[model samples]
Target: MSTRLIIMRHANSRPESDTGLDHDRPLNEQGLAEASQMSQALIDRDWMPDTALISSSKRTQETFALMMDVPCEIRPEIYLAGLDTLLPIATGIEEGKTTLMLGHNPGCEMLIATLCGTYHPISTATCALFTKDGPHWVLESVLRPEALDRFKRVPYEVE
Candidate 1:
């Protein structure tokens, strides 16, 4: 059995708005639309998550709320968590299950690099798919909001 993981960074947030605190920052209009679009793309690909683990930040929570139809667990530790904190949560996932994680940057991007052995720039609302085979995690694909436009005309395949 293969364990699939979809890791996504929270969508575009209103950093400039007077939220007064980073954790309280909410998703902007673009973020909401982007999350909805990503959700549709996942549905089209039949990749809807069975379970999700989300950071407790408002932006992450709001992003997950827009994109999910399954049960989700909020982990407060994931807010700006480092690779050490993120990897264990990922590796502990049982086989034969698909898990999605909505998290913040640096940690999310670093965790992806640690798992798949390459560092890729992770923009807001970017999702990376990986398949775990035994102890190794293999990169399956990555989806971004900007690519959605092209995907409508032609399927995007990661090389």
Candidate 2:
């Protein structure tokens, strides 16, 4: 049995000038649009998640609301968490299920890099895909900076 982890960063945000609340900041126009595209990309790649774990941050919540859905639940630890916070969170996951975790920067990116043994430049609105093929969740391929970059790069020949 294998567990698939698709980790995604929230989409773009409006400048602070445009919003009053950082904690409740909703997605900007560009962010929403990008998230919609990301939703389609997920469907295209057949990377649909069976269950989702998300940061309690508004951005992560909205990203899931706008992009994809597979019975999402909120997890406060992911909000502004460090690398140390990730593996513990991952350990709780059951084997053989596909899980999507919508989280903040550095932590998610750092985990993907560490597990996949490569640099994964996770950008806003980007997703990093990894899998565990054993009873314990193990490292697999790292598809970093997904949805937008991978979808668009092939057409423009941007590697």
Best by lDDT: 1
Give the distance in Å from residue 95's predicted Cα in candidate 2 to where it truly belongs.
1.2
Q: For candidate 2, what is the lDDT? A: 0.72
Measured against the true structure, the TM-scores of the candidates, in listed sequence, are 0.93, 0.81
What's the lDDT for candidate 1?
A: 0.87
Predicted candidate 2 versus true structure: per-residue lDDT over 50-151, tens digit per residue: 899999878888889997657988999888788899877766676778888888888877877766666667777777666775544444433323335643
lDDT of each: 0.87, 0.72
Report the alpha-carbon TM-score of model 2 versus the true structure: 0.81
Candidate 1 lDDT over residue span 1-159, tens digit each? 468999899999997647598999999999998899888878777778889999999999999989877999999999999999999999887689889988999999999999989887888888888898778998888888878863481333556
The Cα error of candidate 1 at residue 56, in Å, is 0.3
